[model samples]
Target: MNPHTLHAPRAPGDIRQHPTGAARLGPELLLAVAAERLRAARPELAARADLTTPQGLLDARAALTADEEGDPAGSPLVVAVIGRFDLPRWVAETCRFALALPREPAATWRRAFTRTVFLAGRPDNLTERFTFDHMAEDGSTAWAGPAPQETTTALRRLLKTLDASRELSAWSPVTVEVPGAPPEGAARPPVHRDLCIATARVTVSQLLVQVNHLLVEAVLDQLIAPGDRLTLRAVPRLTGPAVPFAALRVDADPRRAHQLRAYAGLTEEI
Candidate 1:
């Protein structure tokens, strides 16, 4: 299994996320915690791993880990960086090919279906190019396909009802509409092109910070419900507004589906 994928398991309801606002934990601690994960995987063998063979991967992981020991999950002096798993292809490519954009540079990641309007000076857009030394976790470039669900109507309703006037709101239309245009055909989507705009972008930095902050809530979900599970019934498809993403439609009852022992085993019960 991919070591990166061996993240802290999600607990139902007691979601544990990276804290936020004044509560945000230092990235050093996160690295320490991640390093702890490595320790768990190898026990006393962490120091013995072939750190030299893989070279940068081990170095990168170490740089992000508990370098000084003690409370790996909580510490002073952390390396805090912005970005997440769900990013524009351009951004991902920059990181994958360019060593995670060490110094900022300008770039744009467009959606296959619609125009992508990246606020001109975002960090992901402008960053130091790294040698494409890293491989995507799955060794694939294709974004994961949409989850199965009935989302179109609910999404339209949610969009129509969200109060965009508030400082913090959902379904906010970042773009304004233009004059008449022909309908464009839908095609396979890249990541940012097709996920719910669930994040709050107070700033590009804030966007990364808050999303990672949710890691605390994700952790809590697990702590609150030791064995129960949760599948984020996320809105699928394009990341921006004025763009429609797709979902799987099925007529199964959620509760009844849970009655099956398969409930524990099936993430698709929804």
Candidate 2:
């Protein structure tokens, strides 16, 4: 709890959990984890300055990526982890992907979507034991196929409501259904069949961004640090704010509790 202890090391704490069970991890927790992995990924910066806020995490990740890519260091990285993340499977995958990475983050504005996800399943129900088969050879993205129609519809609706309510700018250009592309003089199938929805799904993902905005990076930097490495399982909190750390267990896996315990190299009793 002291200020100078910013860079000090401590035992990894549980990152997810709440009274309601399967609840979403506190927004602060996400910022914390991102900070820890990101700082560790770039030890040079982690050793200095308190990046315990979401902005701090963003700044730290941006700095590291810029340093690696040979771009100017003064400015922040203008990148984002843009994709559909509200699906149950995606929710699990997003957390797992970023945390397990051995390299710097791909973007500075990384926002993991979970509106649809939270609407769909119990957050705690999401677990590390749920193995994600690799979809890409590089492993940057997961190989999860489309979820069941019920799941898909829920996501679609969630996205629509969030989008319409937010009235976010048309950052994305989307093509609905074209009227008549069949008869007249179409040499081939309509080349421009439908327009791509310009970040519609993405724009509506403010739920996550807003969630983290509360904690920012100041708190996050404390939870996650360079030397500390954690995975997807949720754990009980040893200390810190009620939330951000609440609803988030360090490792939130129930079925694989034994597997996780072994992996962390921790005994039941400490």
Candidate 3:
């Protein structure tokens, strides 16, 4: 019943779209299109310091288009930049098209929509990892992540709930306690649990900014520095009752589990 063990070279439901002569595009072009669309949809996202900057975005696209790399699977480049706050429904939908990478255009689009919905309910402080697949000669590429049926449905429900919830103009701050800074005169407490904090109210936009900062810190701590070569595989794991979710396993060296642990920490939401 292990889900990650199975690798469907092709998803059973896949119905690929083959673009003819003029219609056919290179992988780089397809990625470029995806990136441009994302930029157009959310020009405001560009200014956020905590999230991937416009410069970082350009670098990712340049890497995708570069001819030097051999295997598409080997060069797992960052395609999309997600931060802590939730994305607008329209923007998230647009991103799906970008992630589709010119394959199964219809199905990939649908899957992207489903995935976006699933993400809506997740904690705002979640760290995101968006890697890209190289463009094949035919302009088709594999999905960035696995999509199991049960997980998809679960996400759909979660998205619906999130959509229905009233969006506040502001919310109480989300904070985590760390070891206390002891008073100079007092002996350092034996246990570090005691600390001082009060939640700060933040507007929706402010919340996104805060999350972006958290994401940046988390990635720096957990992920290998950007441009460090890496590899990935679909690792199946049971997420719920009879639900199979294909988790990604990334490594700088397959023989070393340390990097994998770091990758896991980076991708952990909240």
Candidate 4:
């Protein structure tokens, strides 16, 4: 993971010089420049008449764009652009917000819940880029991720072991056999945990791909829970009105079951 320090410019069009002598553009201009570069690099896609611009990207640009009365420091988009948004804090907040909402049917809730979480930072695709780890107030880690795929693999292995154990009587002297256990002469499973944490400096784009492997441990312990609902909203500027981006309800029980099936499918090859 490449770590980057974001320095917000004081005004529109102002260029900030990093310690390494690299110039940093203001968020709005930076995005605009990126958009132009993409358009240039993918001319055919940009020219496609049937393709419409993404609303989230447009909204992000609008939010980041500076106006005479607007202050860049006051916008959450700016914070995200600078890679300063506290993701874990926002994830907790989103969870709390969802739980407080009126419940709905499982299907209805999952659609909404997943949509809200997925769209939180659509322009930057935060969910795919960033993994959230929930550390409980009791000093317990509830979630960690090396990435979603690896986490799913770990959870599936744990679940399979659990299923095997259930098939045997508690008083049985014989050990419950795991399907993929090492051969009798092979080395035993390692007792020490192999923790993989991303500690390298990262740019905003690179940081999104960095995964914390501890999330796999959380999944193995069944510590993760689905929230009932989430509504993703944003204030373009400090004085601007709050724009409702996405909202959805999720039934916890159904969502949990759905997640199990999804993860099982993801790791079927393992």
lDDT of 4 by residue, 1-270 (tens): 110111122223222323433333224433333333224323443344221233333432333233211632221110111112343443333233323333332223222111111111222223354444432232211222212233333232322211111111111112111112233553334121111112222222222221111121122222212321212122111111122101011011122321100000000000
What tens digits encode model 3's per-residue C-alpha lDDT throughout 209-249? 22222222222222222212212111221111111111121
Best by lDDT: 2
Give all TM-scores, in the order shown: 0.20, 0.26, 0.19, 0.18
What is candidate 1's lDDT per residue for 1-270, written digit by digit as tens?
A: 012212332322111332321111123222333344345444444565533223423553454344324332222211122223333332333223222222211111000101111121223322343111233443332111111112122222322221222222334323111112223542321122222323322333332323222221222222111222222212221121232211211111123321100000111111
Candidate 2 lDDT, 1-270, residue by residue in tens: 001111122234233234442223344543454445435434667665465654454455455545534633322221122233432233233333333432322223222111112232222222243333222222323322112223233233532222323423332322222222244553334221111111222234432333222112211322222222222222222233222232221221224321111011111100
Worst 10-residue stretch by lDDT in candidate 2? 261-270
Candidate 4, residue 197: lDDT: 19
Ranking by TM-score: 2, 1, 3, 4
Q: Rank all candidate structures by their lDDT, best first, as comma-separated numbers.
A: 2, 3, 1, 4
lDDT of each: 0.25, 0.29, 0.25, 0.23
On TM-score, who's better, 1 or 2? Answer: 2
What local lDDT score does residue 225 receive in model 2, on the 0 to 100 scale?
22
Better of 2 and 4 by TM-score: 2
